[model samples]
Target chain A: MIGFISEKLTGYLLKRETICQEEYEIYLFGMAQFFRKILVDATVVFLGILFGKAWEMIIFLIAFRVIRIYAGGYHAVTPFGCYLLTILMLFMVLLSLHFISWNLSILTAVWIFASVLILALAPIEVENRPIEEAERIYYKRKVRVFWILENIAILLCMVLHLRMGAESIVLAQATLGMALLCEKWIHGDVRND
Target chain B: MRKGVVKMVLKKVAYHEAEKSAKIICGWFFYQPKLPNAVKKLRKF
Candidate 1:
């Protein structure tokens, strides 16, 4: 659906001289993905609000975005598939958030597990986003630092007994772990042979 | 629709295409795209 819309929109943009014909392919795709994301995000947010799980959705989005920026993950085989996987990922995060909310101990466990994955497999690159050897070394260190800072944020929330904030970190870590698994072990695209 | 909405629409298109192209280019960067399906399929589920 979005792919189709983006095509038509691309035509419209070209006609209006908003984007050059030479650059329109990328622009077409960029617009399609942008609207697709916006539409997807709005739909997910609406669902979250309707189900009274708005906070979970918000936390999941934030956590996923933060980790995803540094730790690239597997891209879907196709554009539509990518959309499906994204929604699925968010749903998993929200579902697990409910379970983790049952006990702070579980949240602690999740945090530790996520920390391990980040330490072990972050700066997770893929065929889609190849990195230079030097760049790879740099991102590895950078990603770990971000992971530690995120963990610290969770710890602060935990110590203060700010349950919601703490839970957000737990949710974030869980989301990160899933992305890592898909990018590393599942896709089997690690840098090492 | 408003004029702002139109511009936002254009920007979004550009970004999406840029992102996708970036990924495709990266795949081409390594031998990933050129890999024999036989070898890669062995790794697949």
Candidate 2:
């Protein structure tokens, strides 16, 4: 629904003759995506306020963004699907916040488990927009490095008694692992159609 | 005046394809910042 509106407004305003169809396509798509993102953020933040943890959600959002930059997760195929995934992920993070007091061993175990899955699936790419071969290799390595640093940052937060930060990182990584596994199951990483 | 169903359908498909194409060209594994150079490299136009 949002995509329909955003696209029509953009198409009506954009001078298609001045620019090529590809450019028009890109602009319309970007606008729809931007609207989708806004909707997700608004809904999540509203839910956070309702739960009386709006600030905590902000931290979780930041951590999720940082981890997501390098750790590829499932990308829903459509706007509605994206909204659903975002909502589910946000609630999952909020629910996981209760694990702040998890025993060191258990948290470490979960971290290790999540790390294995993410490293296994980092740098996953789309088929239609395939990256250059060399860039793919470089990005894969960088993702691994970033994952390690992210884990270390989580540990540091825990040690410093930043419970919210720690739990946010934990949620982010665990969600990443879950997303990768689910995406692989539904659409194998190699066979993205 | 009634809006034709076919016209609405045509607009929906056009927008959907436009969005889908942009998404395809941009890639979808991770959300990287859309830097100008990256956009240039991704889009031939």
User: Evaluated with DockQ, which candidate comes out highest?
Assistant: 1
Q: Candidate 1 chain B: worst 10 consecutive residues by lDDT? A: B25-34
Residue A165 accuracy (lDDT) in model 2? 69
Compare the candidates by TM-score and give the number of the best one: 1
Q: Cα lDDT of model 1 overall?
A: 0.62
Whole-model lDDT values for every prediction: 0.62, 0.60
Give candidate 1 regions above 4 Å deviation.
B1-5, B12-45
TM-score of each: 0.75, 0.70
Model 1 lDDT per residue over A1-193, tens place: 7668878877877877776767665666465546655776686687678767887677656665665656665566565666566667666656665664548678777878877876777666665455566666766776777777777877787688877777866777766776677667666754664
For candidate 1, lDDT tens digit of each residue in B1-45? 697687666766465445543433222101112222222222211
Error of 1 at A79 (Å): 3.3
**What lDDT is reached at residue A25 by model 1?**
58
lDDT of 2 by residue, B1-45 (tens): 133454444445545444443333222223322323323444322
DockQ of 2: 0.08
Which residues of candidate 2, in runs, are more than 4 Å off? A15-22, A99-101, A127-129, A191-193, B1-45
